[model samples]
Target: MAEKGMWPVYGHNTAVHLLQRTLPSPLADNSSQRGFGGPRHAYLFVGAQGIGKSTLAQVYAQALLCTEPSDRPCGVCRSCRLIRSGNHPDFRLVAPVNREGAVDRSAGLLRVEQAATIIRDSILSPLEGRYKIFLLQDMQQANESFANKLLKTLEEPPAHVILLLTATERTQLLPTIVSRCQVREMQPIAPTVIEQALGQHWQAEPKQAQLLARLAGGRLGWAVTQLHNAKFDAERQEQLETLWRLAAANRIQRLAFSEQTAAKGSQPQLFNMLEMWTTWWRDVLLAQANCIDACSNIDLREEITRQAAHLSQESVQKYIQTLKRIEGYLHHTTNTRMALDVLLLQLPQIV
Candidate 1:
């Protein structure tokens, strides 16, 4: 998880240390608990899913608003507690909201109304902390109109307001939005590091830790979340097993499975399955090429290795390319059934 006195943000030591160095040091006798040199007006944290972009942003926000003596975020402070509980007046988070007002990331769209509110509220002075922080989670989902409306604020943010944005990729956002904020590209955590943190911090069993670490694919947040979600783990195992079975299943059988998945019509879940499928083949490719060390699904290496031996390098490469194209296509269209059926039709049948 986290280091002592700091937020439970594991990995990204260099980024963490760089962030800590900017805070006002009690030893330096600066009354400004916020920072020595003022923090940037806006920051954009970019990475893949569950890669700690939001968590890292929240930690930085807490550190800025902490009222404790320590330079780092004291999780026990009123400001820190409020931030954690999402009750802090100074810390406002703007994400895509459903009709129910709950976050619905699957089909969520960050509206222009939310953008307007953020821009309007940003001018006010802080209520509790020295600075008001606006956490814009998942900026990529915002339309171009929303991005354009918010561009002015990013270009000239108020001194007392800090905008923290998270996105899967910088390219998904407008170039104008990307250029205004300081960008932090978080890297994947090594499996070894993840295993240690799980064992030492989360008290994960040695056997369990090793598997989750490998499955995490360098995402500490995913590993930590999965620790408590046994049901999801079981589902993942079933999905992987189903993926393998597809290779041996007849075309009609595979198409039937695709039909079943398409009926569910779960965009996020569909994408997740595609991603899992992509990684599975990639691991097989790695195993076939004798680069087993580079394989992510270590616990499933035996089955992956067997398939690697059965599949040709050229066919594997072709399928990987097709899957990539399908992924990009699915993102732009709503024809989930057809897209998934196309994917199933392209599957390489096992001998």
Candidate 2:
């Protein structure tokens, strides 16, 4: 399903073509950025989580460092292989790390220590490739204090250092940093495209591939990750059961459930719960509208139909808005307990 020469990136072809054009063209001799022809000092890959921003960034780095005579990043080359194995000498991946020191995307914000390392290394030359690439994932998690530390280097980075950053949105980053980079807003991959990739590229079974494509909701990376997560479907089912139980519970019971989940203090759990609840309500709305085929949670069409039968479309819409509001509000508040309480209080009584 991948185009010849664009092996790794299937969803982000425009960005891939743009990066390929910048590879080692005659115009690359100049150190300054030349529109799409020459590489810029910095690039910001913006998209939702589980999108292929990181993948596209790595592919771009491979092409920049690839030694192949033709089709740069001939993935067989030593540089490409090194990067694929996460052992490339000149390529550095910097992201928020948990207390354990391993990279963790949910670790909240990029730390001052990581910025310091990047600033110190910016002056150094490449160890192997012509360009030293630094991939800074989850820039949205970077606080302004830490982000400002790299402004100087980000503005006028060494000609040999190419900075690649990934974030869900540019608005979350400092305006000064945004101005210093070329922003690539990656688009969502179509379900059909993702399904084909699953069957042809990953050799996934046709039926499973079809189901995953619908569940992924246009996120190929999420679909691909689900392939290796043995407990994915089980976890989804658990959330559905919790949702169904809470839907029929009284106000006190609903509030108690929130307290228990919040007391467990797992951010990923809270995220999954909210996202699953929100999307399921959306499916219910679609089902009520007689658009079950267009629902993202089509695998649970029967459950969605049952929910639609019990709830009025108005109440479903209201709860959907409440979920979306809480989602945005949670980004700014640490008092998740209170937010969840408010959210549960607002939900229409299901039974």
The C-alpha TM-scores of every prediction are: 0.90, 0.94
Tens digits of per-residue lDDT for model 2 on 188-273? 98989999988888889998788888777678898899887899889988988888888788989989988997788888778877
Cα-based lDDT at residue 308, candidate 1: 93
Off by over 4 Å in 2: 26-36, 69-72
Candidate 2 lDDT (Cα, whole model)?
A: 0.84
Lowest lDDT 10-residue stretch of candidate 1: 26-35
**Residue 306, candidate 1: alpha-carbon lDDT:** 87
Q: Candidate 1 versus the native: TM-score?
A: 0.90
Cα-based RMSD of candidate 1? 3.0
Error of 2 at 330 (Å): 1.7
Runs of candidate 1 exceeding 4 Å displacement: 1-7, 24-37
